[model samples]
Target: MAVSLGVFSGMRFVAAQPHSGNLLRSVTMAVHVPRKGLGKPGRLLVTSATVSETPSSPKVRGIMKPRKISTEMQAICGVDEISRTQALKQIWAYIKENNLQDPENKKIIICDEKLKKIFAERDQVGMLEIAGLISPHFLK
Candidate 1:
């Protein structure tokens, strides 16, 4: 593996190109860096960057379809019924529509009633804190 350092959009990442003796197999790389509030580190070496063998599952980008919510989730989310995915979508939509997102930082979400319930009555909450708030409302 050729370990090369690359900078994209001011962010640093390690890029590796796979090699077999003298031949270039395929470009396989992994992102190794930590963003704020990501809560964990990302992988370093991407063993397989290029897919040359039989087809594997295709990669899907963008927001995932909201999962159907149980009855309990609706009460906490301040809605009658919703999917976990959908509820998040609505929450996000509300955040965007009302411009409740913090101006200083995009990751910091300013809370209103919709987000307040999701935040469990907290005066303020970070985007990273969202998971912790949602976990309680979800059924085991």
Candidate 2:
């Protein structure tokens, strides 16, 4: 038996699978790739069959999970508790809002008095160092 949906007009014959794994296991997509010499790229039908290839996403955990933050962190993020991801976003927003980036290199942040409190009193901090610098501010 074949199933058809109004939207998926081209996908007329999709074999119904009882397995509760990936719903797109039977669905294949044709992609067109441009080659150096070929006028028309060869059509390839690719199907994601394994759960590992199209697994259902789980809830957020670890640093992504919300947790209580220190007073210094709260001062920057304006929240008593926040996720590591949100904290980083807020810090970056503050940096951009205050125009705190270095004149010569954009990757280096020029810390003002407010930023100095959370950033360990450093006059300058590298963009990559932001993650590590804020790790200590997240309370256990």
The lDDT per prediction is 0.59, 0.74
Please estimate how well model 2 matches the true structure, expressed as its whole-model Cα lDDT: 0.74
Candidate 1 accuracy as TM-score: 0.42
Positional deviation of residue 49's Cα in model 1 after best superposition, in angstroms: 25
State the local distance difference test value for candidate 1. 0.59
For residues 72-101, write the lDDT of model 1, one tens digit per residue: 456545666445566676667767878887
TM-score for every candidate vs. truth? 0.42, 0.62
C-alpha RMSD by candidate, in order: 15.2, 9.4
Tens digits of per-residue lDDT, candidate 2, 37-82, equal 6544455333332222354687889978999988887888999989
- lDDT for position 76 in model 1: 41
Q: How many residue pairs clash in each candidate?
A: 4, 0
Off by over 4 Å in 1: 1-79
